[model samples]
Target chain A: MKRRWRQLIYLLTATAAALFMFLPAAAETPVEKGLAIAREADARDTGFRDSTVNLLMILRNRHGQESIRRMRIRTLEVEGDGDKILNIFDSPRDVRGTALLTYTHKFGDDDQWLYLPALKRVKRISSRNKSGSFMGSEFAYEDIASQEVEKYTYKWIRDEVYDGLECFVIERYPLDRKNSGYRRQMIWIDKKEYRTLKVDYYDRKDSLLKTLTLTGYRKYNNRFWRASGMNMVNHQNGKSTRLEFSDYRFGVGLRDSDFSRNSLKRVR
Target chain B: MGRPAYASAAVPLALVLLLVFFVSRSQACDLSGHASVEGRFFFRDALFPGQEGNSASVALQPEFYHGRRDGSGLTFTPFARFDSADPERSRFDIRELNYLMLGDHWELTVGISRVFWGVTEFVHLADIINQTDYVEDMDGEDKLGQPMIHLSMPRDWGVVDMFVLPYFRERTFPGEKGRLRTQPVVDTDRAVYESAAKEYHVDLALRYSHTAGIWDFGIYYFRGTGREPDFLLSADSSGKPVLVPFYVQIGQTGLDVQAVLGNWLFKLESIYRTSRDRNFFAGAGGFEYSMVNAASSGVDAGLIAEWAYDERGEDASTPFDNDVVLGIRLALNDAAGTEALIGISRDLDGGDSMLSLESGRRIGEAWKIALDAFFVIGSSEGDALHALRADDNVQVRLSYYF
Candidate 1:
């Protein structure tokens, strides 16, 4: 019985030592910690290859008037840069067959194209308007675009419990000041899943402008987590927008040609 | 050759639908489009003898689309209009009815389709595929779909589009009582063509387009009967003075280029043509610079400047010849999606000026209102816009989408 106790203690010590080695180092700075967390989140989402989603956007003004816009999104992942995305409008019948194609980059401005079905024309549009509202919604183009780790500089603010989940509060400053609408964003990410739960957007004047809450997250492919709904409320104007997502297909076989400018005309 | 080259405008759309109906089995078809009612008010008295003032019109454009799981689809769009002031404007058109099949590196579209090619604000010099629906609007931005078999191949370097246009649709003109019509009106029933095939002319067109880095360019060649008609002063069957529309055969080579540099966009469109009667050159170039979210407001303002030049100069049939246009575009970026564009064009040689405004706002969910105005001043006898000096008009349209 004594021999068995000694063997069990040895086994427990070896397991504890191995777990300790795996823990994050205590000497990490706030900036380093924030960056590492972001990198890990990004790395964990690398191999989704392609995805398709159906979305509904509800926009409401302070007067209680509401508007609706429906669309479909198809995305293809890239290895070293930003992803390629296709946006096809399904409602507001005038723009039903209209589509937009975007090829985002890691460092520079993205390339975009807009197709107008009435004219049967494809127009190359400028992407410097990242701060402009998308489809007249409260959500800006920068908010929906591919999120790359290189787009911002990060700093860990603190740790907190949000909605019964332990989270890491981090502050991220926009690197592309010329185009980005925000000066900085405060984010709360779930510690267990690296999923972002909330964000506070500060305008260029460094004033609190909007707050976004993400909810109804579901695991995709047993690896990636996606929010089923996102709520954005503007503090300055009392306008809010809710984006509801559904019918998600991950790792869908989308070819590169489907994201080309030629394909922009075929999004009927 | 080719069974007499017959042409019937309404037959092909029906044929396309019949063919696709038998092939479609597993998809739900969708119906979508817009219906609009508009009122136009003329600021001045009509200039021509038969011209009248103030008009009301209703327009409907409906689209039906069916897609299969095999990457093939069928689409049908039909347009109809009724004008209170002009009989010619009360007409129907098969705007588009086509079957589209997609392949790995290629795509094919059969039946009636509309294709547009150009990069300009006021005029698209390089676009010549479909005949203009001139009776629809004064802006000449509307087109009637053409019967075609289009094949496109996408490659790493560029895209090649080839078209086999089987039939030609005649250009619509304002009726005798229309405000924008010529004095004697065009006698379409007695129209003549340089080719004996007339509306049965089988035109061919091909274009090679490339999107490189920040530049998008298309070079094209078109061999066909020209859409623009030169009117010959003649007499009607009853011996009254009339204008007979005449079409000519022509070969055109055109190029359109655009460069996107951040907030700035540069555009150019040029066309060179060789016809049995004459050869000419027409071109336009411009730039648009946008200021997004300016002054911390959710507003975008874009400044535009363009110059149009034609070898025919004052003798050119279009008003864009030898003119400079300056414009501003604004968007509110609000939930209502409000936008406006205002432009003023000055003729260099004739020294006349024209002003235009197009503004729109979305109402609730599926309704919208638009206001458009056009004004011309000091139009000389030799100027292209001389025919419509007293036809300055403002139009208000309310639309419902479904």
Candidate 2:
């Protein structure tokens, strides 16, 4: 009996050692699980909201010279696969009257339309080269705020402190060259909330081209975080554009019909 | 801060070739190219005197590339052009034959190629990198082919650009007496000697771009010189090269400045020449050559203004003469969410006034078309005039980029 007890003790010791070895390589940790939960909080919220933004764009050449123009935008954003987006603009001189329409999609290309008051005609814009510029701004159409997770391949590079908040630094590479103007991007996700605090864009040349900053996060439905303002500045060019979203409302029974091309003319 | 190193267009090509080689050796890669053929039809209401005629031409541009990361690479851009209406009767031409030698931060290109220099609508002496736009004297289409060696840095000191061409091709002279005639005539036979007298030249250029406090800047400079045509050259026996002089087109120095504020963009350019000659205008139209001739000085200047919104796109081409302009651009979507644009431009030159407008719409997912119409509101004389009619020209283009 004494010999058997000794044998059992030795066996238990070996088993404990093996289990310790595998622990470092084990499943997700509570910290990681907590981070994911934060990310899903806002992502799962299906809400409807109307927002207005005022943007200004300016360009200067090699000489110390200046020119200016103004833009006004009204947008309605809703959560879900078939969310609706309507954008109306007040163009500067020479541009006079112009309006735009966009329908968001979850798994495919979105629908778009433009109305020319001069020609009294309504036209549809395809998704080809959707990576092109948006309103001569440094931002490409895809560069605008579309947080579709599947559009990119993400890797958690590390957990680090950023601006007083612990954040996950996730590196994302676009999966489809056709849909992206950027080569790759790195984003900072706040540990407490999935709200992106910052983003860095790499150009096709794999050069760090632009940086985006998000601020003024307000909680919605006690679960979602929304940024009231965002700014993107092109590092190569001395140009910066800012967007301010206001008057947010969510979960107001929105549907696909609210975001159709036919509905653009009817929107205020 | 150190200047960013730039690889030539070769890096991508090399990456492709390496991928191909690796593929043959059972490695993975991606290779793609677009093959296309384009044709143009020309109808002339008057050829020198008065007659209605039609002409046609076909062109093929083929691009090929192969390479891999940190490895050897190769790219070929070859073109063939054929025209039935060439006044000089040069029916077929090979426009490009280039080979690239690339390294990290630097790219060397050697052989025949076309270099684009200016950013204006109407052609000027400053736009001499290639002769196609200037070769209207060849009757239907002009072939501005040149043999050259070039160095291009994709990125360096906040600037990306190219250096190229060491010579000029002499095409036929439009003749002196024809200057006063509404419709001029050219001796096609004499045009043969022009290309044979190609003069060697070299151009060095650099572009630096930056932005400050809501404004962006685009700065550029070009300097070079060599032999060029003389407009006074007679078709007679004493064809003593009248003005076959070699001087500056971009002068020994050229500078351009562009700025953007809000939705507005402003551009200004100036060139300083050491000496000016007449042969530069030999084969070009009377009105066209005069602007280049007017600035037979040490310096010339140009300027422009532009405004645009998401509702439309603007022309990349700059117009000719007076060096100054004002313009606006707009883009808007429909009540049904379609894309459309409107644009307007005005020339600031004295009296040779011009106004242009353009509009485009996306038909569907596959194609979008735009129509551009321009008219000369006033006329100028004695070297600054553009003999365009009030109801002048229009261009319609349909493009699809997939």
Query: Against the true structure, whose lDDT is highest?
Result: 1
Per-residue CA lDDT of model 2 for B1-402, tens digit only, reads 000011124643465466456556643232322222222222223324332233343444343444444333344444444444443322223344445565655556565555433222232333344444222231112445455666655442333555666555444333322221122233323332222322444556665443332222344555554323223233334443222222334343444433333222333334444433322111111110101001212111112243211110111112333333353333332211133222233334344555555556544333445565555566655322342232244545454422
Query: What C-alpha lDDT values do all the predictions have?
Result: 0.87, 0.45
List the TM values for chain B, per candidate: 0.95, 0.55
Give the docking tier of candidate 2.
Answer: incorrect
> lDDT per residue, candidate 2, A1-268, as tens digits?
9999999999999999988988776756644544454346446543435544455444332242323334555445554554446555543322333567665555656555565532223334444344555654555677764556555566667889998999978777776764566687888888766678998998767899889898898987676677877777778865666666665655544443444433332232
Model 1 TM-score (B-chain only): 0.95
The DockQ of each candidate is 0.56, 0.02
| Model 2 chain A worst lDDT run, 10 consecutive residues | A59-68
Worst 10 residues of 1 chain A by lDDT: A18-27
Q: Please list the Cα RMSD from the true structure of every candidate, rounded to 1 decimal place.
A: 6.5, 21.5
TM-score of candidate 1 against the unseen true structure: 0.93
Q: Place model 1 in a CAPRI quality band.
A: medium
